[model samples]
Target: MTTRRRAAPDATRRSEESRRAILAAAFDLVGQVGYARLSIEGIAARAGVGKQTIYRWWPSKGAVLFDAFLMLSEGETGRPALPDTGDLEADLKAVLRSTVAELNDPRYDEPMRALNTEILHDPALAAAYAERLDGPLKEAKKERLRSAQRAGELRADLDLDVAVEMVWGPLLNRWLQRSGPLTPHYADSIVETALNGLRRPTRRRRDQH
Candidate 1:
């Protein structure tokens, strides 16, 4: 029953070139001067667009930076889908390993760190970031977990919402905290630990009994 809002056909849309320029400008400026010093004026100047043009598409500097972050993430993450091999452990590990690779990319590291700082400081911006950037990825993970639940591979009573967070939380923590290398070894360990906690307890065989 939920209705999704669709853009009006007559809506004034920025040209693809302009949009690309703006995102590129944001990325370059953030890398040069850092996110705290980034502004709509600077981006406009770099992109050769009027301030109104940037404002028309995004409400604030934070929003613009968030969009730029998403643009870069799309390029690095490439469609944000998890593997569904029917083996939940394997699928989870595979997806998390890919995530570790993205986090380790030098191009993304500084820009994402800047964006994360902004989100952490602003509650409203953080909510918007989660909805726009993280929501789709989390929903995909939830869907895959739900499939496993239906197959009796996961506990029926498990809260898939928390389960999704568990799958991602540690990886993000390590990436953000700089506590350890975000390698496949670390990713596999996180998956095994989380899945072991979530998996349904196997019933004993008749011969064992």
Candidate 2:
């Protein structure tokens, strides 16, 4: 008698479907309940799958949430496409402005808040969250900066990586901390402050008082 391989093509398809289901379920639940309150059973019920199915794929609630949020925010274009209109500053501003709108949307708020609270309670989880969301965003923003550099639109002396992080860090800091409701105006300020740069590399880093 011949035995069939366990991981056949149909098995692969089913696995992918199940994984997608789990991700969708996790996102939905996180939107409904804080990540702290979210549970494997909850995700399983939402996904219409057995708890064992989730456990078979993900090790922890944090893992499921991280993956779910990543998939929700990311897409086929890679990091949501940074509006490359050959005008780097305008492109960055437009994307950031839209991102501010996204952050301010009620549906998006809780999952983001959940992610933020997790970061505060668990540094490891925070690192993982940053790796998933912030890191890719930072890289994509940097790539847009690099495009600007190639086009000679930005000062050659500017460090593209530092500029990207500066632009990203402040705006994200606001959203994740709930320091204030995110705004397009804030996004514009970030772009302006970063692009115009502080102290103009001269008057002293802090002498602009």
Q: Clashes in each model (backbone N, CA, C under 3 Å)?
A: 0, 0
Cα lDDT tens digits for candidate 1, 1-209 = 01224655444243656777998898888877877788999999999999998887887777777878777667765556667888999998888898798789866676788888888889997897788688878888888999999988999998888998898998888889999888999999999989776555566444466
Model 1 misplaced stretches (Cα beyond 4 Å): 1-14, 50-52, 55-59, 70-80, 198-209
Best by TM-score: 2
lDDT of 2 by residue, 6-114 (tens): 7989897987788889988888888878777899999999889999988877888877877877777765555544778998778888988987988887677787777
Angstrom error at residue 188, model 1: 0.7
The TM-score values for the models, in the order shown, are 0.77, 0.81
| Cα RMSD for candidates in order | 5.6, 5.3
TM-score of 1: 0.77
lDDT of each: 0.82, 0.79
Clashes in model 1: which pairs? none
Please report how far candidate 1 places residue 146 from its true position, in Å: 0.6
